[model samples]
Target: MEEKILTGRLYDVQGFSVQDGPGVRTTAFLKGCPLHCPWCHSPESQAFYKQLSWMSMRCLGVDACKQRCIKACPKNAIELGVTQKDVKTGTDLQLIHVKRDLCDNCGKCADACYVEALYLCGKDYTVDELVNRLLQDKKFYDRSGGGVTISGGEALSQLDFVIAVLKRLKNEGIHTALDTTGYAEWEKIAMTMPYVDLYLYDLKHLNSEKHQAVVGVPNEVILDNALKLAENGKKLQIRIPVIPMFNHDEKNIRDTAQFCKRLGNAVEVVQLLPYHNLGVMKYLRLSDDPVAEATLPNDAYIEKLKRIFEEYGLPVTVH
Candidate 1:
């Protein structure tokens, strides 16, 4: 492929994440996903478009600073407003509010904010640009058996850009991993196989009906893709998020392990990712409803879930 710009939106680029793959990795979180998993840790990544993230506490307020963002907004969507009065103290704070309905997400406000109190969550990067950035950590990757991981909202949702980045990384001898939900078409996934060294595949639920009800899609395609990937000799480390209300039952656990067992030696490992409310605050940043509170599964419960996969003779790790 010729060297050129191949821009795609990404919410974050995290470094030294040991849990994502074999070693410390720089996980590029591409924006957008087909499924709306309630327990998602990276809620900001769901939308493919750039999001305006306003931090109220970081704001210097109208009195202390020039409101460049307010003037820069083409839609007049930004306005200075009193923060909602505290019911207990009856004290109202001053803040800037973005009328999301009118806001076009042009990111003009983000550029105008000198304090960076207002910022855009996603940014576009060219293939060459992103590769150069990832390659900066080459020494780290070489020493730690680490490389770059393409994660998402759903990495495959931006398939072309992902393949381009992965191909370049592979050329530079950097191991590449694709952390996907496996909800995308098989053809798209197959297109990424040559560039990807490992697949961090997520298995949400065993029952198709339950899966659709929660995640807004049928699991058949996801399951079929997993099996096919394994059959075609792709390395898979199946990741299962153990949500309390959603697939935590004994039967569900056993069924999942049995399914992995069916994949036989094609399965590399089964990672139990216990659900947490780590991204609940992130939802607030995106002006989305926060997930209802749920207690994280205790260590013993996680261990029990791990043992279930062990019973099936599949390698299991609780993360």
Candidate 2:
């Protein structure tokens, strides 16, 4: 049997996202990741398979449902429950329970439910499908010098698919940026480098041991790729997500600054992305453990870190 080409699961194609890259960008979030970073913001993007996510806020109580899901479920995954009682009338509001094992991927429950309590996370798309969607925002890309950014669990994990998409975009004269962890093989990085305009390199940690401890992989490969890109004179922007207990200290900051400085003048900027609980709900949806109970860093500490990078004389942005 022939090997199949693994395309990518596109979670969302967000238009006019300014924070992801310079100007206004259309970001295509690819699915699957090798690194299991504790503080990952898009936890849904990690898994390669199609998974279910429920937004509790969007759920309507059982009063409106017709029990279609209970009948549709093959594994008896869907169960009815009395959610609450009316204060005066003493009537019960029912809800549905979904057993993971019983789910047959039929999607009948999601289709039948009137309220959007259930949602599927990932789906496959071809290169043409992705390019056509991105081209819809060409006017904005032209106006703001913004284009498409390929972000993921890690974009490089799907090397051939990403390259195809990027090459297609370049052929159509669209500016392209890649938000990567730089954990890919050097050859794969080099292959995509020609088509990519800017590189958003993530600097997770300077210490190899600590990097492995948090992200479940060694930092050697990532660091090597970063240096190779820098050596090739690629326009690189180093992004460091300042986690409270991880790389928020002065030592790591200084070391990263030095590394960026060693990249010569090609690297013109460093972005300090402060950690947040934005993805906490995702952990519950995936039934996984949360990374840390630590709080977000205060403004004073963030400002202090900014000054530390400013000592390197490179432009720094704190978010």
Candidate 3:
């Protein structure tokens, strides 16, 4: 009897990623997240299904391309000269446009875009295919104390596929890291615990209401799951994004440090990811309008936050 192949949706597989986990790692960016964080640098990772994206710089305009996307779209989604502000430079220019309401993400227009001005955000990867891509850097992982880090939009969203991928990595003797928001049901997350070597758990905000206002979910379940993971003797590297005006105040930072303190020895490191506008340009690919850029955290501010974490006697690192 032939075994059926399992496939999962992926946003991207980033190679030689030192920031995702310890060592030189190949980070598998699984698609889909429960959180709708406004500060999200990767807008494309939010949806469960694939989404059409437009790269204005790559576009040759309606005249050059002969309205290929406009003509190919079954729903008449593409149009000439709707509006454009150069994504790289803020100046305006005429570029091909995608009609948001009419587009069903059918991807026929993307197929017609030879220049890749129109493209899809997510792709299907079989377990074998993804595993092969991860294994390409096995030598680097072995030598650098690095391994495969399964990061998401929230890896737990695709629980079954993640479990299968993690299990296979563990079988191959690769150090497996699960980077997650701790936003799924406990049972679904529990399935991956056995295979995960380390957890890169994300902590957004401490207050449930404040958390919900920004991220579309409460913090109670996420915090509870973290506690559960620690209780079960799982190693965790707590990742907190130091977003300005959102959760970077003294009280929140202190309270977060306090939470990490309570998590105790299960926590390996408290990594503070300072918020930046580095991903603001990506929003251009996913939206009709430009995203309002947030105030970026300075080095001094990030250092101050790190010192606060250290006040709780928690091991802290800034990246």
Candidate 4:
């Protein structure tokens, strides 16, 4: 049988990135996630379709478009000018109506607009295409011990595509890392492990009920994957997003530390990514809800969390 080719959705291919993994690296942001974590930072990555993001601030009004989008839309979804509607509270709500169902993915509207107010979010690329783009940063990779990091809504959602890309990178002598939620099938994780040199594992919550409540999924599978990876001696860096009113309590921190301790020497480090509103604008662009509305933890809260991890003798970094 002939081998099947795999393709994946990518939102961005960032180069010369240092924070994602070791050294200067190329990061591939894959699309289509399974979990709906209420505090998700990248809400635009959730859907498995080509999304049109409208930045009202970037829009140059009706004069720029020549009404191209209004004509192109089949469902009459695109209407020029401000659309006003009454809210449930009996107040008028003004919104730009872009008939989503009428969009044909032609991107004519985006092309017509000069200021780039309307843009598509997802693009499909073959492994070779992505590899070529990644190799452009080879010089940086060589200097920083960085190669490529595949992150996503969830990298495992596109397992086959990721496997092909990772294998190709490994063949080219590039060190690879996977930033995952560890929510996929074990066999899939095992298949990709040989090619992946590092795993940036996300541990959202310790309690099963709380995990489900916050992330829309139980923690059992994720925990199991971590344990399995540790037992197999995979290089792992566990990360937790410090969201207020969620998993920021001392008990949760201590519990996470204990879990890491059980994973033994396989787990190298823990990173606390303080919640930020950097991605809030993306929510508005995609017309999605803002998940990280809570205020970011103060320096003292962060320091206390770091101390909790230090008690386990585990190396921790706050970012």
State which candidate has the highest TM-score: 3
lDDT per residue for candidate 2 within 7-69, as digits (tens), equals 667777899899787889999998888998888889888887777775555556655666766
> Compared with the true structure, what per-residue lDDT tens digits does model 1 show for residues 24-84?
7888999999999888888788889888888776776655567788989999998987665
The digit string of per-residue lDDT tens for model 4 on 1-319 reads: 9986678999889888887889999999998888887667777788777788888766544544556556656566677557444443454434356665666656777766667778888999999999999988888888878889999989899988999899899998999999999998899999998999999999988999998887788989999999999999899999999989999999998999999999989877899998887877887777644445888799998999999999999999998
Query: Any runs in candidate 4 off by more than 4 Å, and if so which?
Result: 1-5, 83-96, 99-108, 288-292
lDDT of each: 0.87, 0.83, 0.89, 0.84
Model 1 local distance difference test score: 0.87
Could you estimate the TM-score for every candidate?
Answer: 0.92, 0.92, 0.93, 0.91
lDDT (Cα) of model 4:
0.84
* Best-fitting candidate, scored by lDDT: 3
The local distance difference test score of model 3 is: 0.89
For model 1, give the 10-residue run with minimal summed lDDT: 84-93
**Candidate 3 has what TM-score?**
0.93
RMSD of each: 3.3, 2.8, 2.8, 4.9
Ranking of predictions according to lDDT = 3, 1, 4, 2
Instruction: List where candidate 3 sits over 4 angstroms from the true fold.
Output: 1-4, 82-94
